[model samples]
Target chain A: MTKPLLTVEGLVKRYGEHTVLNGLDLTVREGEVVVIVGPSGCGKSTLLRCINALEPIQSGAVRLEVAPISRESRDLPALRQKVGMVFQSYELFPHLTVLDNVTLAPRKAQKRPRAEAEREALALLERVGLADRARDYPRQLSGGQKQRVAIVRALVMHPQVLLFDEVTAALDPEMVREVLDVLLDLARQGRTMLIVTIEMNFARAVADRVIFLDGGTIVEEAPPEEFFDHPKTPRAQKFLNTFTFDAVKRPHPSSLADPTT
Target chain B: MSIAVLRDYLPLFARSALLTVRLGALGILLAVLVGVLCSAAQYFRLPVLQQLSAVYIELSRNTPLLVQLFFLYYGLPKLGIRTDPAVCGVAGLAFLGGSYMAEAFRSGLEAVDRVQLESALSLGLTNAQAMGSVILPQALSISMPALVANVIFLLKETSVFSAVSLMDLMFTAKDLIGLHYNTVESLTLLVVFYLLILLPISILGSLVERRLRYAGSGT
Candidate 1:
C-alpha cells in the first residue's frame, strides 16, 4: 500500500460545552478522493478546517508532506500552502480582479515574480474555464463562475491536498453541476481531495471512500459499493435508507458499470 | 471707509494670516501624527501605551477646548513651564484634534472585514505587513472623508489661538477694532476672512469624500 499523503489522529473539537468533532481519525493515500457527508452541524466542515489549521483542534495531530524537505510535522501556514481550501461561499476577494486574487498569495506568500505568477494564474484560470474572466472582479461573475475561480485560486498554489467545504452548497441547482464538473475533473487528474458534500450521488460516483458523520462521530465509512449496498450499522442503514428509494427508482449510472469486465 | 486705512493695515493682516496658516498647518500635522500613532498603539494591544492613549483621548475629548488651551497657555507657566503663545496654541489644538482623529481612525480600522485580515495571514504576510499592505490602504480609503472633515474643523479651531495673543486672524481683527473703534466692520472683515479660508477647505473635503466613495464603489 502507498504511504498516506495526509493523516489525522484522534481529532477532537468543541465549542463551549458542545462537542463538534469527537476524536475523529482518518487518512488519505496519495491521489485519493475521500468524501464526507452528514447533516448540518455534524462537524464535517470542522474536520476539513482542522486539517489546514483554520480551526485549531483541542487535541489531535495533522501531518502533511512538505516538498523539498519532506517534513512530517505541521507548520500551519506551510501546511496551508500545501493543503488548499475551497469555501462554500467562494470567498473571492471582492476588491481584487480575478487574476490578482489568484496571484496574490503566490506573489506575497511564495515570493514568486509577477510574470511567473501571472502565467500560473492564467493557466489555472483556463483550466477552470475562466481564463477570459481574469480581469473581471468576482462580483461580476455568476455563482458557478465564482466558485470555479475559487477552485482555480486554490489550485494555483499547487497544493498537495485540497479540501472542499460544500463548494456547491451556495449555488443554484443549475450552477451546481458546473462547479462539480470542475471538481470531478480535478479528481480525474489525481488530486488528493477531502470533500464535505451533501450531494450523495456525486459522492457515490467519484469518492474512493465515503464517511458518514452523526452527532460529531463517524457513523460509517467504506468503499462506495459496500457502504451504499450493504451498510452494517443501524445508523448507516437508516442513513442509506433515506436515499435507497431514489437510488432504486432512478437510473443511476453506476448500475450501468461493467461489473463483469 | 478709508483706502489709506486699508492700505496701512493690509501687511499686518497678511502677516497675521500667514501666522494663522502656519499654526493651522503645524497643529493639524501634529494632530494627525499623534492620532495615527496612538490609534495604532491601541490597535496592537500595547500594554501601557493603549491605556495611556485611551486616557489621553478621553480627557482631551471630554474637556472644553478653551479650558485645555487655558491649561496649556496659563497653567503650564505656573508649573514652571514657559512656552510661547503660538507653541501653546498649536499644542492645545493638536492634543484636542488628536482625540477626535484617533476615534475616526479606529472606526475606519474597525470597518474592515475580519476575513480580509485572516486571508492576509493565510497568505504568509506578517500581521504588521498585512496591516500596512492590505488593511491600512483599505482603511485609509474608508477613513479619508472623516479625516478631511476633521482638517476643516481643525482649521476653524485655530481661531482659539486668538485668545492666547497669537495675533491670528481673529486677534488682528480685535486689535484693529480696538484701535479704530470700527467694531462692526472689523468683526465683519474677520468673518469674511474666515469664510475665505474655510470655504475652500470644505469644498476640498467634499471632493476627497467623493473620490474615496468613487474608488470604493469602482473597485
Candidate 2:
C-alpha cells in the first residue's frame, strides 16, 4: 500500500519536565477520516500542533507526503502550506473581515492576487452558509459561524491534509450541530481529516476510525462502529460511561433495557 | 486683550508654537519607531538586541527627562560630541517616551490571543508575516491609548527644553516676558499656547481609540 498521506513516528513532546506525548504514532491515509477521543490531558492537541510544526518535538518526526516536518527543515514552510489546521478556539484574525481572513493565506503565502483569492473565498463562504457575512469581522460572528469561517479559512488553502483540534468544544449546544454539519460535508467530499473532538455522535457518524488515547498514548484504535459498540480497554469503557447520553438519538445507549428484564 | 498687543506678540508666539509642534511631532515619530523596533526585539527574544533594548528602556525610564536632556546637551559635549539644543530636546523626549511606549506595546502584544499565532503558522505564514498581519495591528489598537498618553506626556515635557535653552515654548515665553515685564500678558498667552498645541492631539488620540476598537470578545 502507498504511504499514508501523513505519518507521526515515535513523536515525543514535553513541557519542562513533564512529557505530554510519549512515543506516540499515527497515520492518516489520503481522504480518510480519523477521530481522536481522549480525556483532557491526553496530548490530543499537542499531537496536532506538532504535526503542523506549531510545537517543538523532543524526538521523532511528523511526515507529510513522506517528508519530515521539523523546526530546522527548509521545507517546513512549504509543508505547512499543504497541511491546513483549524484551531480549537476558532482563532480567526479578529481585525480582518471574514473574506479577508479566508483569503489571507492564499493571498500572502501563495502570492495569489487579492481579487482572485477573495472571489474563491466568497464561494467557500457561500458553501458554509456565510456568504452574506463576508464583510463582517470575526467579532461579529457567533461561535458556530466563526468556526465555520475557520474551516473555510483552512479549506481555501486547498491542503492535502486537514487537522481539526477540538473544533467545536467552545460552541453553544445549539451551535455545535452547525459546525459538525460543515465537518461532515468536508468528510463527504473526500477530504483527509484528523480530528480531536469530544462530540461522540458526530465522531460515530463521520469517523472511519476512532482512536482512544489515554496516558499520552493511543490505548485503542478501531472503526467507530466497532469501538463504540465494543470498547476494547477499561479506559475506553470508563470514558464512554462518562458520556451522559444527552444527545437525542436512537434511545439512550443504556436507557432502553430489555422489557424482559 | 488688546488686538494690537496681541498682534505684536502673535508672530513670536506663533514661531515658538511652531517650534514646539515640530519638536512634538518629531519626538512622537521617533518614539513610535523606537517602540516598534525595541518591542519587536523583545517579542522575538533576539539576544544582543533584546539586552540592549532592556538597558535602553531601563536607563531612559529611570532618569528624569530634564537630566537626560542635560546629559545629552552638556555631558555629551564633554566627550566631544556636541549636539544642538533642539536636537537634544527632541532626542531626549523620544528617548524617555520610547521606554513607556515599549512597555505599552509589550503588554498590548501579549494581550493579543496567542492562538492567533498558532493558527497563522498552521496556515503557512512565516513568523514575520503572521506578526505583521495578525499581531501588530491588534497590538497597535490596544496600545493606542497608552501610546497617545505617553506622547502627550512628551509634548508637555518639551516645556522642560527651556532649561536646555532650546528656544521652545517656555524659553520663548520667558524671553518675551522678561523683555516686556508683562507677566499677565505673557503668562496668559503662554497658557493658550500650550492648549492650542495639546487639545487637538488629545482629540485625535481619542478618535483613533474609538476607530480601532476591537469588536471581538471584550476581553
RMSD of 1: 6.4
Correct interface contacts retained, every candidate: 0.14, 0.64
Summed backbone clashes in each candidate are: 0, 0
Chain B global fold similarity (TM-score) for predicted model 2 against the true chain B: 0.94
TM-score of each: 0.84, 0.93
Question: What tens digits encode model 1's per-residue C-alpha lDDT throughout A1-261?
Answer: 667888887888988888999998788999999999877889988887777666757776777753321123334455567778888777676667889888888887778899999998998888888999999977788999989988887888888888898999998999999999999999999999999998888998889999989888889999988887888889888876886576568666777786974
In the range A1-261, model 2's lDDT, one tens digit per residue, is 445899999999999999999899899998899999999899998888899888888999888877899888886777898998988788898888889899988988899999999999999999999999999888888899999999999999999999999988998999999999999999999999999999999999999999998888899999999999999899998899889656535775565676654
Model 2 per-residue lDDT tens digits across residues B96-205: 98888898999899888788887888889888889889888888888889988988888998999889888787887789878877666777788999998899889998
Worst 10 residues of 2 chain B by lDDT: B210-219
**Clash list (residue pairs), candidate 1:** none
lDDT (Cα, 0-100) at A174 in candidate 2: 98
Q: Please state the interface RMSD for every predicted structure, separated by commas.
A: 3.6, 2.2
* Candidate achieving the largest TM-score: 2
Q: Which lDDT tens digits does candidate 1 get at residues B95-174?
A: 99998899889888888776666655555455666687667866777788889888888888888788888899889988
